[model samples]
Target: MNTMTKRLTAVALATTLAVSLAGCSHWSKRDRNTAIGAGVGAVGGHVLTNGSGVGTLGGAAVGGIIGHQVSK
Candidate 1:
């Protein structure tokens, strides 16, 4: 990827991480799991798809759903 794209992706990942952690003070275990799942899924998707945004998003969605259901 280009320098700009890498920078943007890093920024986005950092922002997502920050946002997810910042609001976790009151989150339930399931919420935390979902967040963790989404983060992992995003990274996995990015790796698997060579950083395709659609794959990353789709992975996050699927992971979040799985995480949410896992706690039930």
Candidate 2:
């Protein structure tokens, strides 16, 4: 594959990973933390990756964490 195709593939793979993890379960602090970390990581990752669409999953992850921030 060419350089462009490889970059596209990397972006696509990252996008898929980001989206697929959305709406993940949060039954424990560990699970919650993992989700938050991944979500924030995705956003940072997306920014680092210079992707807009790919950041939706990251946003959701952060949103979920924010939503659950009050939970025990």
Candidate 3:
């Protein structure tokens, strides 16, 4: 990736992490699990798909659903 792309990707991941963690304060266990899953999924997707936005979002959605279901 070029320098600009790298910087943008870094900013996006940081923003995603911050938003996920920051919004989870006082959340229920299920919510926390979902957030954690999404975070992990995003990172995994980025790695597996070479930083694709679609892959990242898809992974987050799938992971969040799995996390929510597993918590029940």
Candidate 1: C-alpha RMSD after superposition: 3.0
Candidate 2 off by > 4 Å: 1-26, 52-72
Per-model CA lDDT versus the true structure: 0.78, 0.59, 0.77
Quote the positional error of residue 52 for candidate 3 in Å: 0.9
Question: Whose lDDT is higher: candidate 1's or candidate 2's?
Answer: 1
Q: Give the per-residue lDDT digits (tens) of candidate 3, residues 1-72.
A: 665775677568758787868866899889888887777677667656777899888888887888788799
lDDT-based ranking, best first?
Answer: 1, 3, 2
What would the TM-score be for candidate 3 when compared with the true structure?
Answer: 0.69
Best by lDDT: 1
Error of 3 at 51 (Å): 0.9
Q: What's the C-alpha lDDT at position 68 in model 1?
A: 81
TM-score, each model? Answer: 0.69, 0.37, 0.69
Q: What pairs collide in candidate 1?
A: none
Residue 1 Cα positional deviation in candidate 1, in Å, after optimal superposition: 2.9
Candidate 1 lDDT at 64 equals 81
Candidate 2 lDDT tens digits, 1-72: 455764675567667656765655534765655565655555555555455556746665665566466454
Residue pairs in clash, model 3: none
